[model samples]
Target chain A: MRFQLALAACLLTGAAHAATDIDLFFPVSVQGKLANEMARLVEVFNKDHPDIHVTPVYSGSYDDTNLKTHAAIQAGKPPAVVIMSANFVREYVISDEIVQLDPLIEKDGMTEAAFMDQFWPALRLNATEDGHAYGVPFHNSTPLLYYSVDAFKDAGLDPDHAPVTWQEWIDAATKLTKHEGSTTTRWGLMMPGTYDYCGWITSGLAMSNGGEFYNTGYGGEVYYTQPSTIGAVRFLDNMVHKAKAMPEGVTDTNAVTTAFFQGRAGMMILSTGSLSFVRDNMKTPYRTAFLPRSLVNAAPIGGASLILPKGNSPERQAAAWVLIKWLTSPEIAGGWSRFTGYFAPRIAAYDLPEMKTFITAHPDAKVALDQLVYARGWFSTYNVVGVRKALEDGVQAVLSGRATPEAAMAKAQQEADALMRPYVEQTALKVPE
Target chain B: MVALTGTTERPVIRTRVRGRVRPWLTAYALLLPSALFLFGFTYWPVVQVIRCSLTVRGFRGAAHWGLQNYARLFNDRHFATAVVNNLIYAAGTIIPSLVLALLFAVALKETTRLTSVLRTLVALPMLIPLVAAASLFAFIFLPNAGLLDHYLAKIGIAETNWLGDPSLALGSIIAITVWKNCGYYMLFFLAGLAGIPQDLLDAAKIDGAGPVQRFFRITLPLLGPTLAFVLVIATLNALTQVDHIIVLTQGGPSDATAMILFYIYQQAHQNFDVGMASAATVVSVGFLFALSIVSLRSLERGIHYET
Candidate 1:
C-alpha cells in the first residue's frame, strides 16, 4: 500500500511539473461584456493548450495595468504577458521593462519584417521600435462619425448620403438640432471631451485639418499651438458656443453614448472601438461614416497590444510566446474583432469567412475597417498622459466657455513644451554645433 | 520536575537561566512579525519616497541634486491651479458638510420612531461607496434628462451642465461630497450631543434662556472637542476623498476639481514622474500636517471637557 501511494504521488508531481503556469494581465478599458469575453477566451486557450496553464488577471484601466505590471516587475514577479495600451509601449521601451519579440519570431521560423507585415501598416509604428517588435497588435481603432438615420431623415437630410466634408457636416448638424423655445430638445453632435479620448479625437481633427498634433516620428515634441490644432479647437468650440450644435462643456463617453442611444444626439464622433457597444445598446437606427474632414481624411489609431514584460525566465518567455501567438492567430483575432468593436489588427483576420459574414451583416464594422486607410499614429510623447492631459485640459476649458481656442491651444502648447523640455534638452538640444 | 535538593538545583538553575533568556528572545521573536511588517511596508516606503523626492530618473546614477523637482513644480501653472483648486475644494466641502451634519444631528438627537427612520434615511448615503455615490450623482448631473436638470426645469431654470461646465463642475463635486459625508459626520455629532448633560440645558431654560440661547450657551459649548475632532477629520477628508472626483470630472473642465492627492496620483501613475510625485506627496502631507496642527491648536485651546 505504501509503495502504491508513493507511485501515485510521483505521477501527480510529474504531471504538475510538465505544465507551465503563466499569468496574463489584461484591463477592461472598453466595456463589461468584453472583460467577460476575455476571461472566456483565456479559458478556451487553456483548455486547448494543456501543456500550459494560463491565468487571466483583470487589471484595471490602461493606466492601472501599467502600474500593476511595473510594480510586479520591480518586485521580481513580472507577469508573463500584459495587454498594455499601445501608446504606453514607448515609455516601457525607454524604461527597458519590455522585451523585444524579434528572437521569438525568428525561433518561430519567421523574419521580424514578415511577422509585422501580418498586422495593419498603421499599427507597426507603435508596436515596433529600432526594427524590433516589442508588442503584437491585437485590436486597433480609429475615430468615426456615427449619425442617427431617424434624425437625418427628420432633418431633411439624405439618410443614405453621410456628410463627407466639415462644411456639410456642420450644416447637417445645424439642421438636425432641435429646440423648443430656449431649451435644446436634441443636440446636433456629441463627442467625449474627457482625458485620453479628448486628446485622441482632437488629434484626429488636427490631422484632418492638415497638421500633426505632435511629431509623428519623435517622442519629444508637440505642435499644439499650430494653426491646424487651433483651428480644430475653434471648430469644436464653435459647435458648442457658436453654432450651438453641440453641448457645452466636457461630456464623457458614457454620456455621449447614452445621448446617441436616446436620440438626444443627432450625430457623434466616437472611437471605432465603441462600435460593438453602440450596435448592441443603440435602439435607434444609426449609420457609420468617415469622420468629416476639413482638408484631408485622418484618424488617430487607438487600442491595446499584447506585450511581453521583461524579466521572464527563458522557459516562461517561450511559454508566453506560444500564448501570444495563439491569441493573435487570425482565427482568435477575427473572433475577438467581431465580439468587440475594435477591428482586428492582423490583416488576414479580415479574410476569414466569419469576419466577412459579420462585416456584411454589420456595415458599421466595414466603415471602421475602411477608415484604416486614413488612420495615422496616435499622439505619444515624453510624459504622454500628462502632455495629452495638457491639451485635454485646455480643450475642456474651451468647451466650458472659459477660454478661446487661441488662448487655450497656446496655453496647452506651453504646458506640453514644458513637460517635454527635460527630454528634449537631453536629446535634441544636447548636440554641439 | 520540582527540585528539592541543592545538587538538583544546578542543572535546573541552568534551565531557569535558559527560560529567562528565552522570554526575552521570545518577546523579540513575537515582535518580529509586526515590526518587520511595519518597517518593510510603511516606514521603508516612506523613507524611499522622501529619498526619491530629491532625485529624478537618471542614466548614470542618482541624477539631479536638491530641490529641482520642487523648483519645477513651483513654476508649473497646472501645479498652481491644483493648489488653488484644492483650497477651494476643501472650503467647499468642509463648511457645508459640517453645518449640515450639525443640523441633522441636532434634529435627530433624541432618536424616537420617526426620528430613527429619518436618521436611517439620512445616513443611507454613507452606505454607498464613494465611486458608486459619485456615479449616482453623475447620472443626476446629466444635462436636460438628468434628475437635477429635470427638477430645475420645472422651476423655470434652463438646462445646466453640472459637470461639463468649468464654473459649475467643482460646485457639483462639492455637493456630492457634502451629500455623502454629512450623514457620516452627523452620527459623530449625535454621539457628542448624547454625552452632553441635558440638565444644563434645562437649567439655562429655567434661567430664562430661549431655545437658541440655551443651544449656544449649553449645547454648543459642551460639543467643542467633538467639533474640533470632526473639523480635522472633515478637512482631511476634503483634501483626500478624491475617488468621486476621479469618477465624475477626472479633475477637469480645466482642473477645477483637482486636489493635492489627486494631482500626486496623476503625477505618479499618469505622468510616470515618480520623483515629481514623491515631492508633491511630501509637500502635500507637510501642508496638511501643518494645517491640522494649526487647526487643532487654535480650535481646541479654549475648549474644556464638560461631559
Candidate 2:
C-alpha cells in the first residue's frame, strides 16, 4: 500500500515537471566558433533550470540570422528569443514584429527607467525604439583604428601618437604606404566593405566627419548629400585612388584581417568585435585608437541585441525574459565580453574583479572602452537596408574611381530620400487636419 | 444504333458500369497518398500564401487587410531589379548549359577507351553539394586570394572581381552555374545517345557522309526529343537557383546579381514582408507559366518522326 502511494506521487511529479521548452536563435557575427559556445551555454542553462529547456538554433551571420528568424516567424515557427542586429531593432519596432519589453520590465516590479539604467547609456539609443525598450543590449562594439607600431616607427611617425584628425590620418597613411616601382609593398589602410559592414563603417566615417548620417530621433531621414558625408567620401576616394594608400575597391573583413596579419597593411579600421581575432592572429605589436576625426572625434556603436519576437505564449515569454535577464546579468555579460572582443553592454560588468583583471592584461581593450565615450548610435531608419545600400554604393563608386565624392553623395542622397519616402509620407509629410 | 435489342443493351450498360467503377476506384487508390501530400504541403500553403498576400502585417500574422503588399512590390526598385535579373539569369544559364552539355556528349561518344574516366570527371560537379560548390567557387573567384584571380595576376592580366563588380557579378554567377549544371545535363544526352541505333550512324557514314555530316544528319535528328526534355528541366533549375548565390554573393555589390527567388527570400525572411513576398511568388508563378508556354511550343516544333 505504501509502495503504491509512492508510485502515484512519482507519476504526478513527472507529469508536472516536463518543463516548458523554448528555442533561441542566435547569429555568430564575430566568429564561427561562438556558435558552438552559444549551444553549450544553452545546455548549461537548461540543466540548471529544471522547469525550462532551451534549444539554441545556430542562425547565420547578423544579416542572415535576421532573414531566417523572419522567415521562421512567417512560417509560424517563431523562436521565443533572438539575438538580432542592434541597428535592425528600429525596423522591427516599426513593423511591430518585436514585442515591447517595457511591460515585461513593469511585471518584474521595476520601471523601464530603472531597467534601462543597468546598461551603458550609449547602447540604449539603439535598443529602445520611440521611447519603448524593444531590445535588450547584448554584445556591443565600436570601430577602432588598428595601427602597426613597427610600421608607424618605420614611417618616422611616433608609435605613441595615433592619427587624431582627418588630415593627420591622410598624411600618416601616405607616409606609411610603401611602393616598389608601380607595385605596392604595403598598403596604408584596409577595412571591410561588404553589405552590413560597409554601411556600418561608412556611418562611423560620416559621424567622425561631423555628419549626422541619419536622424537619431526619427527613422525617416538621413543627411547623405551633406558636406560632411561628401568629405568622408572624398577621404575614401583620396585613399584608394589618389594617395594609393588603400585597395582600389572594397575588401571584406577576412581580407582586411589577412592583410593586417601579413603586414601588407600599415593600418586598418575594424570593429572592436575583431579585437580577439587581431590579438590572436597578429604577430607584430599593434595598438587600438579612436577613429580619426574630420571635424570631430566620433564613432558609431554597433553589434547585436537580444529581442523578444511577438506572438509567443505567456509561459514561453516569461521563460524568455528569465533567460534574457540572466544572459545580460553582469557575470554572464562580462564573461562573454572577454570571450568575444565586444565590450559588455552592462555597465556593472566592468566593476567585477575578473573584468578588471582582464582589462589590465589586455590594454588594447582599455582603449576600446575609453573610445566609447565618443560613441553614438549606429545608422538605422525605416528602410534600413535600402538607405544604407544607397550610401554604400556611392562609397564603393568613390573607392573604384567611378564617381567623384560630391557626385556620389548627391546620387546617394536622392536614392536614400526615395527609399525613406513611404515612412516620411505617413509621419512627417502628413497634412495636419 | 446500339439498342436494336433491349436485352443486349442492358448487358452492355452493366459492363460499362463495372468498367467505370473498377478504373475509378483504382485511380482514386493510386492518387490518394500523393493528393494528401500535395494538400498538406503544397496546395494548402499556396492557398495560405494567397490569403496572406491580401493582408498588411509583418511576416508572422495578419494585423490588417488590403492590396498594399502587391502595390508596394510593384513600386519597389529592388523588386523590379530582381525581376530583370531573373530574366537575364534564365537566358544566361539555360542556353549555355544545354549547348555545352550537348557538345560534351558528342565529344565523348566518338572516343572509346578510357572515356569512362572522362565521363566520370564530367559528372563530378553534379555530385558535389550546392553549398560546397558555392563555397568552393567563392574561394576560386575571391578577388585576390582566389585561384582565378591569382592566375590572372600571375600572367600580367588584371584580376577580375567575380562577385563584387556590379556589371560582371551576374555573369560570374552564370558561369559558376553553368559549370555546376552542364555535367548533370551531359548525363541525359549520354543516355539519349546510348539509345540511338548504331546502324543509323553507320548508314550515314556509308552514304558519303563525313564525321560532321553524320552527326548533323543522323545524331542531331534523333537527339531532338532529349534536347527538349533537358531544356524544360534546365529552365526550371535556372529559374529557382538560390544556394550558390546565397553562399557566394548573398545578392550584393549593390544588388547586381539579385534573382527573384533570392529577393523573395529577403522580403519574407530579412524584411519580414511576407505578404509582399507571397504576392511576388504568385507573380513569379505567372512568369513561369508564360515561360513554360514558350518552351512547350518550341518543344512541339522540335519533335520529329521517321520511318
Candidate 3:
C-alpha cells in the first residue's frame, strides 16, 4: 500500500509539470549586451518553471524587430511573445495582430485595475489600445542631455550649469567649440540624426519647443508644418549651418557615442537607456541634464514593451503568459533595471530593496526617473513607419543642407498626410451618406 | 530498349510514337526541375509584379487613365531626382570601373611570378559581399572623423563631409561602387586579353606600333564583344547595386544618391506604398529590357574570331 501511494503521487507530479516551449522575439535597442542578459534571465526562468520553457531570439533594432514579427505572423509562425517598440503597439492593435492581455489578467482571477496597478500610470497610454491592455511596459527611457565636465571647464563655463534653453544651448556650444584657423578641434554639440533615433530626437525637440509633433491621442494627424515645428527645424538648421557648432547631416548612434567618448563633442543628446553604457565606457567626468526647452519642458517616453502576438497556440500562449509574468515580476524588473539604465516600468519594482540600493549607488539613474513627470507618449500613427520616415527624410535633408527648413517641413507635412490619408479615409472620411 | 519498327510475327501491337517520345521525355525530365522552380519563384512573381503595377490602390479600379501610380511619380521631385541620379550613377560608375579594369588587366596581363599574385590582389574586393563592402566604406568615408577624413586632414586638406554633403554624397557613393566593381569587371577583361592571339601583338610590333597604338589597334578591337557583355552586366549592376547607398546615405542629403532601385525599395519597404513601388519596378524592368535588346544586338555584331 505504501509503494502504490508513492507511485500515484509521482504520476500526478509528472502530469502537472509537462513542459511547453515558447519563443520570445526580442530586440536590444541600446548598446549594452541586453541580448545576452535576456538569454541568461530566460535560462533561469526555464529552470524555475518546469511547466514552461522559453527561447529568446535576438531580433535586430526596434524597426527590424517590428518587421520580423509582422513577417512571422503573416507566415503563420508568430512567436509566442515579442518585445516590440511601445509606439508600435497601437498599430498592431489596429491591425488586430496582438492578443489583449486584459482577458489574460482576468483569467488569473485578478481585476484589470489590480494588474495594471503594477506599472506606472504614464505607461498606460502606450501599453493599451481601445481601453484594453495589449502590451506590458518592459523598460522605458526619456532623452537626457549629456555634457562633458572637462569641456565645459575648458570653455570657461561652469560645469554644474548645463543649458536650460535653446538659446543657452547654442551659446554654450559656440563657446565650447574650439576654432583654430577655420578648423574645429571639438564640436559644441552633436546628436544622432539617423533613422529611428533621428525621428525620436526630432520629435523630442519639436515637443520641447511647444509643439505636439503629432496627434498623440489619434493616429491620423500630425502638426509638422505648424509654426512650432518649423521653428524647431529652423533651430536645427541654425545649429548646423549658422552656428556651425554641430556636425551637418545624419550622425548615427554609434558615431554620437563614439564622438562623446573621444571628447570630440562637448554636449550630446542620448537616451537615458544609454546611461549604463555611458557610465561604463566614458573615462571623462560627465553629467546629465534635462533637454533644453524653447517654450515648454517635454520629453517623449521611449522604450520597448512585451506583447503577446495572435495566432499562438493555446499551449504556447499559456507558457508565454507564465514567462511574461516571471520576466515582469518585481524581482526581475528591478534586476533588469539595474542591469540596464532604463527605469523599471513597474512601480512596484522600484519599491524592491535591491532597486532602492541601486538608485542610491547610482544617482544618475534617478535623474531619468524624475524626468518621468514630464514624459509624454511616443508618436504612434495609422502607418507608423511610413509616416515617421516622411519627417525623418525631410529633417535629414535639412541637416545635410539639401533643403531649406521651410521647404522640408512643408514637404514632410504633405508626405505624412498623404501616407496617413488612406487610413484616414477608411475611418475618418467614411460616413453614411 | 524496345524496337518499334521491327517485324513482330506474333502480331504484338507496337507503338512507334512511344519510342519517338522517349528521347523527348528524357530531355523534358531533365528540364522539369529547373522549369518548375523558374515558373514558381521567378516567372510567377514577375507576372504578379506586373499585375500589381497596373493596380489602382486607394479606391478600387480608380486609377487615372490606368496610370495613377505612374502618374503620381511625375510630380514627385524625389522620384525625378532619383531617375537623374540613377543615370549619373550608371555612367559615373561604369566608365571609371571599365577604364580602370582595362588598365589593371593590361598591366597585369602577363603570368609572371609577381603579376599573378598582383592579379589576385586586385580581384580581392569582389570576394567581399557588396553590403559588407559598403559597411567598410562607410567607416572610411564618414563625415567628420572618418578614416579617409583623418588622412585628408593629415595632408592639410580641409575636412569635407564625404558621404554627408549634398554635392559630394553621390560622388562618394560612385567612388565606392567603382572600387567594388572594378575588380569583378577586371577578371572578364583579363579573360578577354588571354584569348587575344599574341601573334597579333607581335604583328603590331613588327608594324612599328607603340604599346598604346598596339593596344588600341589590336587588343581594343578584339575585346569588343567582352566590352559589350561587361557593359550590359555593369548597367544591370548600376540599377541594382544599391547596398552601399542603403548603408551609407539612404538616399539622403535630399535624394542625391537616390537611384531608381533604392527609390522603389524605399517606396515599398520603408514607405509601405506597394502600388508606387510596383509602378517604379515596372518602369525599371522596361528600361532594362530595352537596354538589353540593344546590347544583345550589338553583341551579335561585335563578336570576332581569330582564325
Candidate 4:
C-alpha cells in the first residue's frame, strides 16, 4: 500500500507540472551576433525553468518585427512576448493590441509605479501610457560621440577634452578633415541617415538645441517648424554643404561604421548599442563622449522593450511573465547588456559586481551611461513611422543641398501634420463644443 | 410514314447531344481543383484588396466604405516621386539589359566547349541571389574605400558617393539590376538563337549577305517572338523586384529610389495603413494589367512563328 501511494503522488506531480511553451519574438537591430546571444540566453532560460519553455523567434529589424507582431495578432496566433521598439508600444496600445502590465505587476505583490521605479526615469515615458505600464524596459541605448583617439591627436585637438559645444564640434571636424587637392581623402564626421537612424540622430540634434522634437504627452503634434529644429537642420547643412566636413546625401549605418573602421572617417555619432561591435572590430584606440550641445546637452533613448502581445491564454501569459521577469532580472539583464553593448535598463543591473567591473574597464560604456541624465524619450507619435519620415526627408534634402533649412522644416511640418490628421481629428481637435 | 421518320431522326439527334455534353462534364470535373485554387488564392485576394481599398479603417470605429484612401494616395508626394522613379528605373534597366543579353547571345551562339565555358561565365551573376548581390555591390560602391573607387583612383578619378547622392543612387541601383538580369535574359536568348535554323543563315550567306545583314534580315526576324516574350518578362521583373531596394536602400536620399512596391510595403508594413496600402496595390495591379495588355497587343504584330 505504501508503494502504491508513492507512485500515485509521483503521477499527480508530473501531471500538474507540464511545461508551458511560449514564443518570444526578438529583433536583432544592432548586429547578427546578438541574435546568437539571444538564442543562447533563451536556452539558458529554458534550462533554468523547465516548466516554462520559451522559444526565441529571430524577427528581422525593428520595423519588420512590428510587422510580424501585427500580422500574428491579426492571424489570432500572437506570440506570448515581443521585444518591440519602445516607441511602437504606444501604437500597439492605441490599437488595443497589447496587454497592459499594470495588473501583472500588481499580481506580483507590487504596484505599477513601484515596479517601474526599477528602471531609469528617462525610460518611463516610452514604457508607460496614461500611467499604465505596457512595456518592460529591456536593453536601452543613447547616442554617443564615438571618435578616434589617433584622429583627435593628429588634428592637434586634445583627445581627453572632446568637443562639448556645437562651435567646438564643427571646428574639430574641420580640423580632422583631410583633403588631397579637390578630393577629400577622409571625412571628419559621418552619421547614419537611414530611415530610423536619421530621425533619431536628427531628433537628438533638435533636442540638444533646446527643442522638444515632438510632444511627449500627445501623439498628434510635432514641432518640426520650430526655431530649434530649424537651427538643427542648419547645423547639419553647415557641416555638409558649407564647411564640407561631412558627406553630402545620406549614408547608411554600415557605411558609416565601415568608414570609421577604415579610418576614412574621423568621428561618427552612433548608438551606444554599437559599442560591442566597435570594440570587437576596431583595431585603433577610440573613445566616447556626450553629444555636443548648442543650448543644452541632450540625447534620445533607443532600443527595444519586452511587452506582452494580446490574444494569449492565461496559462501562456503566466509562463511569459515568468520568462520576462527572469530575463529582466539583474544577472541576465547585465549579461545581455555586456554582450550587446546596450546599457542594462534595470537600475540594479548596474550594481552587480560583474557589471561594475565591466563598466570600469570600458569607459566608453561609462560615457553612454553618463549621457542618460540628458536622455529624453524618442520621437513617437500617431503614425510614428510616417511622421518621422517627413522630418527625415527634410533633413536629407538639406544635407544634399536641395533645400534650405527653413523651407525644409516648413515642408516637414506640413507633411507631418497631414499624417496625424486622423488622430488629431479624433482627439486634440475634437472640441467639446 | 413521315411522322415515323421524324421521330427516329429526333432520337438520333438527342443521342448526339447527350454524347457531346458528357465529355464536357468530364473535362470540367477534372479542372475543378485548379479552378478552385485559382479563385481562392489569386482572385479572392484581388477582390479583397479592391474591397479594402474602398473602405476607411480606423483604430476605434468600424471601417466604412469610402474613396478617401484613393484621394490620399493621389495627394501623396512620395507616391508621385515613386511613380517617376519607377519609370526611370524600368527604362534604365530594361533597354540596356535586353541589348546586352542580345549581344551576348549573338557572340556565343555556338555550342562548342569554349562557348559553353564563356556562356557560363557570362551567366554567372544570375546565380547569386538579389539580396546577396545587392549587399556585395553596396560594399563595392562605398565612397572612399570601395572596390570601384579604389580602382578608379588609379585612373585619376575622385571618390564618388555612389549610393548616397540622390542623382547617382538610382543609377547605381540600375547598374546592379542590369548586371544581375542581363545574364538571366541571355539564357532565354540563347534558347531562342538555337531555334533559328542554320539552313536559313547558310542560304543568306550563299546570297553574299554579310553577318550583320544575315542577323538583321534572317536571325532577327526569326527571333521576334522570343524578343516579345522576353520583353514582357523583363518589364514585369523591372516592376516587381524590390528585394535589392530593401537590402541596399529603403527608399532614401530624399525618396530618390522609392519604387511603387516599396512604397506599398512601407505603407502596409511599417505604417500599418491598410486602406492606403490596398489602394496603392489596386492601382499597381491596374497599371500592370494595362501594361501587359498593351505590350502583348503591340508585340503580337511583330511576332512570326515560322521562317
In terms of docking quality, how is candidate 4 classified? Answer: medium
DockQ, structure candidate 4: 0.59
- Prediction 4 global C-alpha lDDT: 0.91
lDDT of 4 by residue, A34-107 (tens): 88888888988888887887889999989889989999999999999999999999888878899999889999
Once fitted onto the true fold, the runs of candidate 4 whose alpha carbons sit more than 4 angstroms away are A1-17, B1-18
TM-score attained by model 1: 0.94
lDDT of 1 at B39: 100
Decreasing TM-score order of the candidates: 4, 1, 3, 2
Point to the candidate with the largest TM-score. 4
- Report the lDDT of model 4 for residue A387: 93
Error of 3 at A362 (Å): 2.1
Model 4 TM-score (2 dp): 0.95
The residue pairs that clash in candidate 4, if any, are: none
Candidate 4 residue-wise lDDT, B30-108, digit = tens = 9999999999999999999999999998655578999999999999899999999999999999999999999999999
Candidate 3 lDDT over residue span A1-433, tens digit each: 9999999999987885577879999999899989889989998998898778688999988877888898899899999999999999988887789999988999999877788777877787889776778998999998999999999999998988889999999999999888766567788998988767778888888898888887867788988898888888899999999999998877777777887888889999999999999999999999888888999888889998999999999999988988888888889988998999998998888888888988888877887888887788899997888788788889988998888988988898898898788878877788999
True contacts kept of each: 0.69, 0.15, 0.37, 0.63
Off by over 4 Å in 1: A1-14, B1-40, B58-64
Cα TM-score of candidate 3:
0.93
Measured against the true structure, the TM-scores of the candidates, in listed sequence, are: 0.94, 0.89, 0.93, 0.95
Give the per-residue lDDT digits (tens) of candidate 1, residues A1-433: 9999999999997887688989999987876488889889999998898888889999999888988998899999999999999998987886788998999899889999999999999999889877889999988889899999999999999999999998998899899899987888888999999888999999999999999778767788999988999999999998888789999888888788888899989999998888988988989789999999999998889999999999899888988999999989999999998988899999999888998899999999999999998888877787898899999999998998889999998898888887787778777778988
Judging by DockQ against the true structure, name the best candidate.
Answer: 1
